[model samples]
Target: MSQTTIALTYDNLVNRIVPGPQSLSYFVPLVVLPIAFSIPPWIASKQTLCAVALPIISASLVHAWTVMGGIDVISFDMLLHSYHLLLFNDPRRHFRRILAKTATAEKTRTPKVGSRDGKDESTTPQYIEQPYPAKWSGRLPWIGTLLISMRFVDWKIGSPSHDSKQPDRNPTAPSHLRFILTAILRTLSGYVVLDLTSAWTQQDPYFKTFGVSVDSPLPQYALSGLLPPRLIRCTIMALQVWASVGQQFQLPCTLPVALHWMGYLPDAWSPHLWPTFFGSFRATFTTPNLGAVRNFWGRYWHQTLRYYCSGSGVWLANLMRLPRRSQSRYLLISATTFFFSGIVHIGLVPPEPIFALKSANQIRWLILVFFWLQPVGFAFETAVSVVLHHIGTPRLIYTILNILWFTAWCCFVLPFLGEAGRNLGYWRVWPVPVSLWQGITLGKWLAWV
Candidate 1:
């Protein structure tokens, strides 16, 4: 294989920078968000708070999409952070309500010791302070709850169903030293995986199709032949994009946990807060054969954005006055959530490449269609499963069929997503300081940025 020459330039280095220009000014609203929401409800009505905060959130998102230039994922982060601020409206009310419910459930489940029939008969609020002390009066508790609300993905305040599996939110958090050590290992592993994937992706000409104009025909690369070599190449491209994005998502989950361990971040976070952000995709692969798609997105995928993304759907449903648990309501919520998710993901598309391309609209639509189809795919799986079951299909046959269907579906949609990502310079930039893959492939071990 011929090696692609590595070129270093100031422009390339700027693209790799963590924060874009004027990032500090961009973050001023984010830093102020918690404080704004933390103001005592008695002092300021929720309406007042929303009036004060919504415009800033809107402006931040506008700024991120239009102006933010460095590291593409920052735009995605800014959008999610905005969702978080909106969803959690008031941190004190939100966290207090959740903690109270948790305590109530714990009391109901365990009961006070010696209470008959699992009943807590005490006049006292039993198990109310299980996670932390009730008498722990200080600014620390308030600070912790606010920080936790910021990171909490499970028990999303505004979500419709609230049935998504809640991974342990407040695990026995590790110490600062342990957090740092674990973060180091996690970071190094992620860096290595990304570097190796980048090296592999560098060899694929399919990924190099960056400037296809609207007037020009879309290249039929994947469809050129349905042979094993081409098929494998497309599959590898999908996996490469998958692993790269997963590493980017997983790497950030470590930071909040580390800060929590350092006592800089107060407790009250999500399962993603645990160092175990990476899980085997097969862990959620069992049962309801049609659930492969759902399991892939809901279970195995990093859900850092789910709470806020799904919350938008819930908000829309409430606006329409849909009855909770109704089928139409569920479908509406799911569709809206998926639609919003697609729009937010446009942030991942680097504007630089799109601007250069004559067919920027094509890339935008590809991203939108990819995300908007998620709910449709889930619905289709369900519909097909029902039909197959009605025909008395054997369980084993159905399972095989389900897996094949999912594989074929992936083969159909992943290329569009993968190509958009590649065009946006997803795997092109080298992230790690040193590269073993580069040494093997490019004959050098140093990264340009």
Candidate 2:
């Protein structure tokens, strides 16, 4: 009879059980803030009002969440270590050993203590550093080691590197004076231009319908007051632009693995850069209200359509009205892509509410389905075009349908689903006008939160 045997060595165990760099990299993007708010004025000009503003705000919020989450993780690790020590009756140790080894290595690499002129003093005895006392050692458990490994991977993949020996300083700010002056000028210019344009444009009949009275000086002054806040906002915006540019443009110095994994492969990634450039351009030139409906449709729905139907040949076949013999193959491919897209949406949900409630999964599914169905519906309508099509849908009927849809979904269906559904759309949690009013009335409460 053959006997089963198990053999384990320290290195083999470590390799098998210990977390690696890749684990860290995967977590970093989830925790670290993306280069938001850093869009240059030229790029910001390309985005619609909502797109331009929302991303920057969201980035800052994510950064805050990451910082808080890190603190909580650290505190919990400490608690776990304390619990382990109490339960096992084996006082946690081994941190000093690691530190002593690290210290010894550093000493060998560089001159230590009082060694003058970069020369070793042969007169004095060299002492081997001892590990920290067993009782006081802050050794992390195996799980903590894995957590640290994952954090390291994330930092390695996503963190931008700078020369550690060099003093870190803001490259954008030459001095405190320059920073203040720049902020003031940007605020003033943005405000003056906005006010002047509002005054000129308000003379149109459209302004009256929109409740914007150009003749009222009080309203104009109130609007102009929003400019100063932009100065503070610009600092964050500048940082975002710098980070994005560094990440996208300065690929030579970035980690080779990250570039390879992202499919950069020499120059294939340059095409990806065009989106940022085009988005910037679009944000700048596109007027909000003139052809507003068409602009919004193109910017939002068209991109959604293109994104969903990008890989599969079904969209093209459908467009050309071609009937292929392999209907099953097309259906299978479409279904798989749709399912993958749903998974991608779920994956994109921010980490805070990773559970059932507040999960981004539902929104992702809705958005994906909307993109797929909207185009198909439109195509059907186009195929069945009629002479009276221009006036086919009444404005009041459309307005009622929109109200009914919002009420059925946002106010009713979502809350009934689960905690996730209720918390999912934070953006729509409060009416914008009401929120602003509350902010004005309860300034401290608004600021605290």
Candidate 3:
């Protein structure tokens, strides 16, 4: 669905991922490291301490979880083969023959016992192609990234707290300060929206009743027959989308702004970071785009997880020899990427205690089903878009249709998703920023008056 991928520099350490006997150990560091580094800067007071402390712990655990779990490396070929063998006792005996042929060709092309250049080639083993980060020129980008990351950390550790003095209004700071302040307030509002959503369905009785897995093979979405469940699903999904804007922008984005104003975050990371993380929520929340599934996902919802997920699809599509632009290729890519995403979502459950997210095995699979179900819907959307575009429909009509389509899809799927997410304790997960909202709202009302 969302073809975004974050560039990871490492490869997988294993053929498959499963809970280990000491898998519980993965949870240990997330808790220990945060508490270990719990010191806040001198600027932090009682009210603002948790705000500063929480992001550090979150970014640390998410980073650590990626490294320790081999979340960065996913071999779709090997993964698919493993699943096939486990589920159906099929080892894909065909790939073995292809591999054998490939080995023979390489051997035949190389120096042999009686070949002319055999001795020379064998004597001098040339490094034909080196992997990333091995060459002199290759290190420049990474060097730049390193410098930026250091600057980011420096700013984060020294950023101004909630109780700290504010920047000068137009009379005190530079003109650009206005933009930064606006963003901070905006993202803070987003977090407020998220808090509201969490409060709505925090106890999810139906989700608790469903317990470990789906009650039937199919979901019992129409709780009060059809209308009531759909309406509730619609409302929650709207709130969820609203909250996502806040969660993504409010914390990760605003903290940097506070730092930048306090002379911590550099100009380099600030400008681009806010739009990518914070403004993404707007892409989903705004009119004409909200229910447009393809754009909403491709543009809005897909900021962080694309680079990893899409590689699997592109690689697999190549193997399948599915040509680009064909409906078959589109469907195959969507299916593969979404399924891998299901795997990734399962991995997202920090191998820790079940605190915010549902980490139990059976519940994890149900959560994964939320991801796994996406491709079919996306594929359907792709087909409809293609047909409508070919008939030369007006762009406005095309968009309206897509919006309706998107709304219907959300109504169908979000009931299942809302339940799963709420079950994971996503309800009221983050602390509410009461002062931020109150201040912003008061300023707005005063300006209006």
Best by lDDT: 1
Each candidate structure's TM-score, on Cα atoms with residue i matched to residue i, is 0.69, 0.25, 0.50
RMSD of 1: 7.7
Worst 10 residues of 1 by lDDT: 125-134
**Runs of candidate 2 exceeding 4 Å displacement:** 1-309, 314-344, 350-368, 384-421, 425-439, 445-449
Cα lDDT computed for each candidate against the true fold: 0.57, 0.30, 0.44
**Ranked by TM-score, top first:** 1, 3, 2
Please give, for residues 1-449, the per-residue lDDT of candidate 2 as tens digits.
Answer: 01212245543322222211222322332232122212222333323323543344345434543443321222223222222222211111221111111123443454344432245633432223222222222322222332232112111111133112112222232222333354455444443343333332233222222222222233332444554322322222223323333223323323432353355542212222112211222422233222222232344222322222223344444455655645444444345344434333333233333222323445445435533443333333233333224557554454444333323222222222222222332212221222333445545223214
Query: Candidate 2, 398: how far from true, in Å?
Result: 13
lDDT of residue 43 for candidate 2: 39
Query: Over all chains combined, what TM-score does candidate 3 have?
Result: 0.50
Looking at model 1, residue 322 earns an lDDT score of: 89
Better of 2 and 3 by lDDT: 3
User: What is the alpha-carbon lDDT for the whole of candidate 3?
Assistant: 0.44
